[model samples]
Target: MNVEYKRKFTAVVTALALVGIGVVLLGRDRVNAAGSGSITGTVKLTGTPPHMRGIDMSKDPYCVKQHENNPAKMENVVVSSDGGLQNVVLYISEGLSAGEVSAVPSEEPTVDQHNCMYSPHVVAMDVSQKFKVTTSDQTTHNIHPLPAPGSGNIGWNKSQPPGAPPIETNWKAPEAISVKCNIHPWMHGWQVVVKGPYAVTDEKGNFTIKNIPPGSYTVTAWQEEYGTQTAKVTVAAGQPGKADFTFKAK
Candidate 1:
């Protein structure tokens, strides 16, 4: 073969080799993301569930009208028929690497006030991750978040009129902040801030925190009324770990 052709062939071979290496590295990254373990469990409540007080919205005709036929009740303690608890925040409280702890989500989480109630009732978000608070009700509403002292999060109260733009905000520290609507005193919710992945229990009390790196972790479950319960969990690559918790009745 000609020297010129030989040189071109060698260059093409080197380029293909580089491309193959890039592909392999990309695959490894994809595998690392997809192969990470998860934490899944059920949060249950022991003993009889507390009675949820029904809210008297007659003071506000708008709120009353919203729940005209169906009355609204406090959600401090919501337990399923089988003793499963709902709206519990489950997250890795400790043992996460710096990379996992600092992995703030790009998309902002949202809390919406609709029909005189906070949608989802509970939200779990990463610290420093911005989140949105919006009102969808026709009536004016106030967003008041009371973060615990020393939690590094400042408490704020703001009013959001109907159709107002969403309020974007973030928590500087990790804490479970109690959120309420000052206008509608009965409206209540929680914002659970954490440094790593977290999950909220569903109606059936099931929660799953995904993409957790393999390690032993201190998993905690926090409830608005029951406080917090914790358990130790060990996660392995491509496998799920269990950390069930049971809160006792008061």
Candidate 2:
């Protein structure tokens, strides 16, 4: 082959080899970057359940059938520090690098007050993100949030006449916020204002948060009625770790 032609062919081969090596290095990086762990466990209530207060079964026609003559009395509905669960807010306390709070935030979460009860009594949302507190009853409802110290409560006293638009509004804060409806007196709820992603346990009292970078972390669990429980967890790359918290009734 001509000398120039041979030189061109060598250059092409060298370039292709470099690209292939680059691709291989990138694949290795992706493998190492798969260093993520998970947190999972059952949050159980460990004490005698509290009594149902604040709801009137006689007033709202829907209460008796929907909640079945007092949901506050159900075992699954109780918030116990010792009995093992309710309003469980399990989340990473800190240390892992985190992104800024979403600008404009995601869709607002819904907290509904109906028939003198806060549906999904325990709520959680990212800090500074917008969320909606709504009412379905025709009565006057006042939303009172017990915000963190130095953080004033966000209260809304909007009359919700029957068949009227829901008494709704948005709240954005950086700490766990307790909520209540003063009109019903028995209606109560909680908002766990986490700094980042978090989840509340389901009826089975189980929760799992995935894709956390390997490291030591403080996992906190909070219930409106049962108060809070916390545990320390160490995560290794590609492993699932457990941190269970149990609380007793006072």
Candidate 3:
């Protein structure tokens, strides 16, 4: 029975090896959150808010009905009552090591088409991170992502009819890709693809990028309309770093 024992021993060794590999991958996605730090801050919009362009959804009866209570308008610069900004993307721009930059999140971000408008006006993603596009409206929509020429991102335009399956995909490079719908000319959004951990500002202009290792970093905030702003901060283990920013409405 010596040969039978040897075979069983080999099988156990192989199984252990596979488990080790699995742990490594799991660690990358979870990043040992217990030992990691986070960056938190608020983004404010100073000065008077710009007059957003009104959207004419008369072309689609379904779209028009969806916004009967509240009219549609351009989301280029949406500000809260307290002057907080919405849809601002924040990410670790400098001081991240190669390993951190390559730590693509396992979580998937989704952009939904609702009421003939993009639910969230801006989406931030890490390079190679998979995201989804979904349609919630009754009308058909053609998603057109326009990345700059030679930016290493191939652009694609696809149509999604009502109740269509979600379109899942990922980007290979970092760039601010503009997303539009051919069917709805007033529809506009953005995919700010970057490297490393990122966060998007909420309606109150608050954000927090989690799972960052304790260290000093240069944080960058990007607003589609007013450009970008940067700041330096230090994160401590189990504690959070803070960096607040304000942009004038030009």
Candidate 4:
């Protein structure tokens, strides 16, 4: 009788322990689900895109050879055959709380130099978020960023030779910083830094800005050539809000 009672008590304790753990896990899942939201949209061009002039890489034979198969062209106004606008930076221009404004992304964005052109043509990042500048060319290139004065974001220019290490850094303020390679005059790109969550439009103009808390925000979409457009959106917990924008070609 005594042995049987002890066995019963042990079984009961084991079951209770399992139940307690299950409850904790369920609470954690619920808290995570309630914490954040997302915003999704597409950016399109309404009118016909102006003809982008072909880049002349004759000054650097290495750059010319890199683009021998597929010639390089200006990316000032890249529009897909379906009117999808690429290289546009969309961010929360307003309506962010103090906590949200301080939340910077951990993932690093990259601006790669391939075939004497900046891949993606434009890079968007949150303020104080680290980004990398890498090169895939055999020739030496300079990384020069021209930030506007009094913007609190100082300017820097560094030389990146063949097989050199990546230049890792972050911006201090929100601005569209223009980047260029002095060696290759045709090389041009933009590093758009803004506060809070942001996303860059893909080739199809699709974008999704994640980790946004529940609130109404003023979202802005900026294209290097067409300028900026803003829209208002409201996000709910665990739900994705939608806002699309169209930039008319001038």
Candidate 5:
């Protein structure tokens, strides 16, 4: 073959490879609600469960009506007496582009104080996002942040009363911030200050994140008591990948 022809052939091959990679990357991230990848699996326990502590189901005036005499299970804090899993935070680790990120901040995410309980146990929001702290019931509640972890947190306090205007606050921290009501000590919840979109698992230990770009990622699962767990996952075009997490109580 002629030298010029050989060089031209090599150039075409390299261009095709590059295009193929780009197509693959694009295909992976375009599934549904966002993309073509998937992350689904179970989060099971790994060790001895931690004895329940610091939770008073009886403390929340609103809970007594629903769970009489039963020890209050902290929201999203899964406890399996048979060594089951708890608190898993699975997320995409790689093959994602911030340019196409859809986990945008809502103009208003309401956090209501009802029956002295924080409605959503785990709330996810973007940094610098606006979220309302409102009270729907007659009780007075305060949103207390447990100092942003790793940012040398100085517990910040805000008071919200029923009939009063909602408090507009920006989450300046990058990590998850634990919020509680000092007045109602048993009132507990969490705010996930995420850069992108995320969700917390429910009581049955199930989670699903949609619209991920197909590729490899390190999905992370986190629990208040169990710390953080991560696993490697690969997603294909228009397909959901099963990515489960496990956390054994220590």
Candidate 6:
């Protein structure tokens, strides 16, 4: 090969190698960004779980029909067969700075009333994020959310008739608000207001809070009936953290 052609070929090969290196570095950055660490654990009941009281929907014919074949039970404390506690809200109660905290999701989280019961017994969301309250029941229902005073969240009451549009709202502060249906005294649920990422335990009592920036944090698990428990957790980038909790039955 001519000297000039050989020089050009070497330069082209070097440029190609540099481009490949750049591509690999870019991919690594993308992976690191997408590989934020997560916290996961299971909540268990250390003692005997209380028996859930049976709910009576005889007053409202619609509710009665909705649960005629499958009666509903109080969800104050839901326990799995293996003693795992369900519906517990697990969240990073502290340690995130303003910049590290995620912004409120544009999409609203929903609390659905279905079959004379709240679809999810417990719901959690970031403060100031839009929230939706909806009902699929044929009966007219009044939703009353009672946030504790001094929590900076204003409490409100509104009626949602059958097929009514979802009620959009937001909590200005962080608080675990209790929600109830005045029309159906037995209907109850919780709206957990938080400043950062949170998770609710499933029927199996497992929970996972994802996309958390690496840091030392105070993780809390809250149960409507059993109260709240806290634990310290240290998370590293691209590594999973574990924070298990156990609530003793009262």
User: Candidate 4 at 65: error in angstroms?
Assistant: 0.6
* Candidate 4: tens digits of C-alpha lDDT, residues 1-250: 9999999999999999999998999888666753568899999998879999998899999988988898888999888889888889999888888887888889999999888889868999999999999988899999999999999899999999999999999999999999998988888899999998899999888999988777899999999888889999998877788999999999
The digit string of per-residue lDDT tens for model 6 on 1-250 reads 6999999999999999999999999888766754477899999998888889898888898898888788889999888889889999998889877755656767677989998898798988888888899989899989999999888989999999999999998899888899999999999899999887888899989999887777789999989888889999988777778999999999
lDDT per residue for candidate 1 within 1-250, as digits (tens), equals 6999999999999999999999999889767954478999999999889899899987789888889888898888888999889999888888888887888878788989978999878988999999999888889999999998887889999999999999998999988899988788888898889888888999989989998878899998889887888899998777799988989998
Candidate 5: tens digits of C-alpha lDDT, residues 174-203: 576788988888888776665554556655
Q: lDDT for every model?
A: 0.88, 0.66, 0.92, 0.90, 0.66, 0.88
**Lowest summed lDDT window (length 10), candidate 2:** 73-82
lDDT of 2 by residue, 106-209 (tens): 76777777666777777787766677766676555667776666664464455554555644445565566667666555666777677665778876678886
Clashing pairs in 6: none
> Per-residue lDDT tens digits of candidate 3, residues 1-250?
9999999999999999999989998777456653378999999999999999888988889999999999999999989999999999999999888988898899999999999999788988999999999998889999999999999999999999999999999999999999999888899999999999999999999999987888899999999989999999999766799999999988
CA shift of 34, model 3, Å: 7.8
Which of the predicted structures, 3 or 4, would earn the higher TM-score when compared with the native?
4
Show pairs that collide, candidate 3. none
Off by over 4 Å in 3: 1-35
Residue-pair clashes per prediction, in order, are 0, 16, 0, 0, 22, 0
TM-score of 5: 0.69
Runs of candidate 4 with Cα error greater than 4 angstroms are 1-30, 34-36
RMSD (Cα, Å) of model 6: 3.0
Better of 3 and 4 by lDDT: 3
Instruction: Evaluate residue 15 in candidate 1 and report its C-alpha lDDT on the 0 to 100 scale.
Output: 100
> Better model by TM-score, 3 or 6?
6
